[model samples]
Target: MTEPRTFTLRDDLKLALELADAADAISRARFTALDLVVTTKPDRTPVTDADQAVERAIRTVLAEQRPGDGILGEEFGTAGSTSRQWIIDPIDGTAGFMRGIPIWATLIALAVDGVPVVGVVSAPALGKRWWASAGAGAWSSDERTPNASPTRLAVSGVDTLAEASISYGSLQQWDQAGHLDEIVSLSRQVWRTRAYGDMWSYMLLAEGHLDMAGEFDLQPYDMAALAPIVQEAGGVFTSIDGKPGPWHGSALATNGLLHDATLAVLNPA
Candidate 1:
């Protein structure tokens, strides 16, 4: 019997980067031409259109390139096999994108049997892209400096909450989750706190600019692309309760040294 062919981490990472490129092309154009004059009542038309368009573009490419792989996308939901799936959030911060904020990004991740092994986050509006695969260190590049080499990312060395800088996505989310008191308590212990919000906070944590980040009410599409990058950058990515993987409905990312301490604070009996 012949053995099944296997793909390398680098190969998957390259495909993920290509997927991000296609996604950025569609998302950036829509965001640039967004009609801010239209009703601002959180109408889903613009973002929903962009989201579906980007996902379709990515799915087309994947269908041709990796016919055997499964896909889980925000706009389209799940398809194909669950063993080796691609999780996608065509635009990670739709509200920000719709509002002409440049913090939105396309998130792509490859999960084999539910564990993400590769991740790519492309924020074209911000002129930045970050990516990683297992064993390969997390890295980022700036379109503003086209010729510059990609920089390897690393989380900070801060080991204590008292010295760490942290970000939580929103006070309202915490309050709604009934964890507002814990968040407030954590902020008091941290050296600094900000509600940078969305995927940017976790990206900042991976880049070592922030020591920790956590949030409630997240989906796998919102977090799968981030887990590998944070993990490869020498950080910890888990639920606020400390369970591994993006299956949990919430997230807590920190410099590895502070994960346990932060989890304790958020989950005290």
Candidate 2:
């Protein structure tokens, strides 16, 4: 396929939002439906008819509008050029979604080369959507505030772990990764801790409602959309081991002021 003309980050962000809208239309309708088919992937993760349908919807649009860009999706594997790939987790919390929980989301990201420049996360069951582009501030909307404007997001200013509230996706994940002790120890030092699980933890962190969030056993699609939103909201996103980008298998995110402190605790010498 011939490369499409270059697009600005803002343009990509706009298209990402459109993709999210299409995804929500499919996913929201299927959520909790009695006829919804659920299956287990080779990795033992739950996948539903809704998950595959949502990815197909997004990919269909991307194929028509951004055919030059490649896609790395949870349901459908990669295709096209990586230079301007779109990373997607059609349903980031499929387990919760399959169980009728309102915590799942469709995560979409436009990564130029390897760094995400645009991201959108839409959780229709929760009645919220958030997005950001590099150089554009993060913003979110809620169905409760239908008449109001989108709110600009910024991370909390808590500068110490003792003053910070944090979320760790799942204790099981940490234990499986051999970092259970580290997360538990760090939890004791924080003002509060919750195992919110999946994309919600990171999105809450981006909204400044939570000061830090970390987890292990993540794929690039799981964290790619999140890192951009968190970073644009004045927070930091990196691997638990302190590397940048979602290529790393784990994630550690914090309000900018507390990143080093959190890292030191997690990586105590």
| lDDT per residue as tens, model 2, 1-269 | 96558888878999999999999999999999999999999999889999999999999999999988999999889999758999999999998898889999999999998999999999999999999999989999999999999999999889988999999888889899988889989989999999888888988998889999999999999999999999999999999989999999999999989999889888878
User: RMSD in angstroms, all models?
Assistant: 2.6, 1.4
Top of the candidates by lDDT:
2
**In candidate 1, where is summed lDDT lowest over 10 consecutive residues?**
36-45
Q: Which ten residues in a row have the lowest lDDT in candidate 2?
A: 2-11
Q: Per-residue error at 112 for model 2, in Å?
A: 0.3
Over 4 Å off, model 1: 1-5, 34-46
lDDT of 1 at 149: 94
Give Cα distance to truth, residue 201, candidate 1, Å: 0.5
lDDT of 1 by residue, 9-53 (tens): 888999999999899888878885745333222424344577778
Candidate 2, superposed: residue stretches over 4 Å from native:
1-4
Tell me the lDDT of model 2 at 182. 90
Q: At residue 260, give the lDDT of candidate 1.
A: 89
